[model samples]
Target: MHIVITGAGRGIGRTLADRYRAQGHSVTGTARDGSAEIILDVTKPDQQRAMASQLRDTAVDLLICNAGVYLDKSESIVGYPTEMWAQTFASNVTGVFLTVQALLPNLRKAKGKIAILSSQMASHTRAPGGSYIYRSSKAAVLNLGRNLSTDLRHDGIAVGIYHPGWVQTDMGGPAAEITVDQAVDGLMARFKDLSLENTGCFDTFDGQAHAY
Candidate 1:
């Protein structure tokens, strides 16, 4: 598979890139630091278009929208800085939208799949309090996946919103239950099984579907 992963400079995204490469797949990664195959800021349309230009003639089998940020340190919504909340949404939500939108043509050529990196906290059915900024952003991504799936169904593209679980990465912190390798491995397993029939579903790394 020719896969494109975002936020690949570090953490789960980096680990996923490595894993895919190890599996002998062609992988392209994007990050703000310019450390991957492409330097892309998901919030910027110019950057996304530039990245698309770089892959213009190529068809990507998979696009993983994995770039995100957390504001767990903030105490409460009332105490949260509105600017910070907007920034978080820009990276986590809007970034995913722009990146996927920019890459749709390439993906359509391949009848590809899009895997969005969401969070367990996004589940309204299993709602957990706190981390309001992070939680809400992920929830928004879940909806994006749903709407995108509906809109793209006739295009033969599959979309999945996934929770990698509490991975032991910078975002998940050191005490997280799963290692980045394990998390990525599980997601890969799930990715292999994704199909248009299940597009718009929310899933965890372990292959179980989540309540949206």
Candidate 2:
């Protein structure tokens, strides 16, 4: 499988890239810092275009939108700044849209699947206080993924939004609920089993349905 993963410089994205490569699959990992095969800041249209040009209609079996930011992790209700919201949304929301849009042609050529890495925080049922910016951005991505699933259905593409669990990563923190490997193992299964029959699902890494 030829996979394109954004934000593969570190954390879960990095681990996914490594694991996929270990399986002898072709992986095109992108990051803003030039730490991956493609240097793409997904929020930037020029960079997204550059990525498209580099791939040049190459058949992409899977596209994973994983680049995101959690800027309001510990912000107080009165302390959430306007800039933080804008920045977080840019990376977490707009970035996902642009990446999917730019890669649509490649996906179409391969009848591909898009796995959007949203969060459990995106679900209204599990809504807790705090992380306003991060939560809202994730929710937006989940919405985007759902709508994209509808629009792209005619193209034979499947789109699924995922909560990768409270993973032990830089974003999820060391005290989180699950290890990276555990999350990845489950997530890979989810991705592999994703099909048009189950498109637009807002689900967890461990193959469980999540309330949206």
Candidate 3:
């Protein structure tokens, strides 16, 4: 499998990249910094297209839209800074939207899988109030995944949304329950089990289905 993963400089993205490479797959990790195979800033459409063009003649078996950021402080829904809200959407929601759109042609050609990194907080059924920016952005991504699944189904592309759980990464913090390796391993296992029958379902790394 030739896998393209974003946000590969650190955290679950980096771990997943390493694990895939170890499994003898050709992996291209993208990040703003570090020794990424592709240098990409997803928030920038030109950079996203340039990166996609690099793979124009090739087939990508899996596209992992994993780049995201969590705002340091929580905001009230009514009182949130518009600038901060827009920035959050820029990376978390819009970035995923553009990255997938840019790569869809390649994915369609290969009949590949598209996985978006969402969060447990995206679950409407278990919605807890707080972390307005982060939560709302993740929820948007989850909804995007749902819509993409429908839009891309006829093209034979499988789209999914996954929550990596509370892994011990920079975003997850040191006190998180799982290690980066564990989370990525679980995610890989889930990815392996994906099929058209389960397309568009939001799930955790453990394969547990989540409510959208």
Candidate 4:
């Protein structure tokens, strides 16, 4: 399968890229620093268009919208500036949508699957008292993925939203619960299980259905 992953320079995205490549699949990893196979800042329209055109002739078996940010992690109720919210929404919410829109054609060509790396924080049931920007952005993306599933159903495209767990990465911090390897393994399994029949499902890395 030909897999394309955004934000693959580090953390879960990087691990996923390595794991897929080790399994003998064709993987296209994109990073903003031009360090991966493709240089793409998901929030940039020009870069998104360039990526789509570059892969215009290729069929994408899986498109993982993994690029995101958690800008308000340490911000208090009074600390969340308007710019922070805008930046977070651009990276986490709008970025995911743009990637999906840009790759719609490639996905259609292969009847591919889209795995959106949302968070348990996105769920109303898991709501906490912090990270307002991150939480709202994730919730927005969850909504985006669900609606995309409905809109793209006839095209044979499946979209699944997932909470990848509290992974020990630069974003998740070293004290987080899961290791990168563990998260990657579980996420890969979840991705493989995605299908049209179960499109728009919000699930955890370990395969449990998460409350939307």
Backbone clashes per model, in order?
Answer: 0, 0, 0, 0
After superposing candidate 4 on the true structure, give the runs of residues whose Cα lies further than 4 Å from its correct spot. none
Candidate 3 stretches greater than 4 Å from native = 72-79
| Per-residue lDDT of candidate 4, residues 125-180 (tens digit) | 87767988899999999999999999999999999999999999999999999999
Q: lDDT tens digits, residues 1-212, model 3?
A: 99999999888888889989999999989998855888888899999899888988578789999999887344566667888888889999999999988888888788999999999988878767888888889999999999999998898888899999988887788889998888888899888877678889899998898877
What pairs collide in candidate 1?
none
TM agreement with the true structure for every prediction: 0.97, 0.99, 0.95, 0.99
lDDT of each: 0.91, 0.94, 0.88, 0.94
Candidate 4 C-alpha RMSD relative to the actual structure: 0.7
Candidate 2 similarity to native, TM-score: 0.99
**Candidate 2 lDDT score at position 198:** 100
- What is the alpha-carbon lDDT for the whole of candidate 3? 0.88
Kindly indicate the candidate among 1 and 3 with the higher TM-score.
1
